[model samples]
Target: MALPIVAMTLSSCGRAPELRVNDAVVILSPVDSNPAALYFTIHGGPEKVYLNSVLSRSVIRSEVHESKVDPKTGMVTMEPTRKIEIPAKGTVEFKRGGKHVMLWGVNRPARQLKELEAEFIFSNGDRIIVDAEVRAATAGDADKKDAHSGH
Candidate 1:
């Protein structure tokens, strides 16, 4: 009896939950050779999921990264991250000095359009397309200590 009930419950929620991506922005590097940063928010739905990756044809390279504080050096370090786990009914923010995406070589079209349509892929094989505002990097963004200038 319990086995049957469990099977029914699982079957009832077979589909992926309603995940949403918002507040996406891609700031182009002022130097043109440096990679740009992408920040966004992922709102979880009824079930947990993993953010597999972010893709965009507008950029030459795209990757997910995170910032961590090194205990020994007492400094901040940025590294590449394969995936990010989003809790059920929770939210994950990709911002500066934290988990964020890096886009390299903003193409002419993307720069001209001033936006990048980024595809957020999930573990459940769902893809959410979002228009991320693109802006020119400022002098403050070139600060290497913050690691936003290049990485």
Candidate 2:
């Protein structure tokens, strides 16, 4: 009917929220060669998109990772992720106990600057560069440490 067509048209259209990254930060490890986690949020655009990669000129190694706790065992685990999907007009967050970027071997320059500049690449061919403030390790860092040490 006419009403159905109108609904379809409305559904097909969306107002992209400028497709940005915000509140980026890198939680630095006190020990050298230890891993760091990058957290941020991605505001969605006009269409569904995939976060392909998170790159850093400040660190030699980085990847998208997610943490999960087993319901039966109550054991937490971390795993590398390929791509993260962001729905249109929606938001995806990279936060502790959730999706985040794990980085290693942060060079002295980034530490001196107290920030890490990361590149967020998307499936829609949109790339966003964000400066994540570097901060000292906190209690939330224990999970990453446990996972790394196999403790």
Per-candidate local distance difference test: 0.87, 0.85
Per-model RMSD to reference: 6.2, 5.5
- Cα lDDT tens digits for candidate 2, 1-151: 8999999999999765678899999987767768888889998887899999999988888989888888998877888989999998899998877898888988888988898889999998999999999887876576444344331
Can you give the TM-score per candidate against the true fold? 0.83, 0.82
lDDT per residue as tens, model 1, 8-69: 99888766656899999998877778898999999998888999999998988899999888
Among these predictions, the greatest TM-score belongs to: 1
Candidate no. 1 TM-score = 0.83
**Candidate 2 lDDT score at position 14:** 77
lDDT of 1: 0.87
Residue 151 C-alpha lDDT in model 2: 13
Leading candidate by lDDT: 1
Shift in Å, residue 33, candidate 2: 1.7
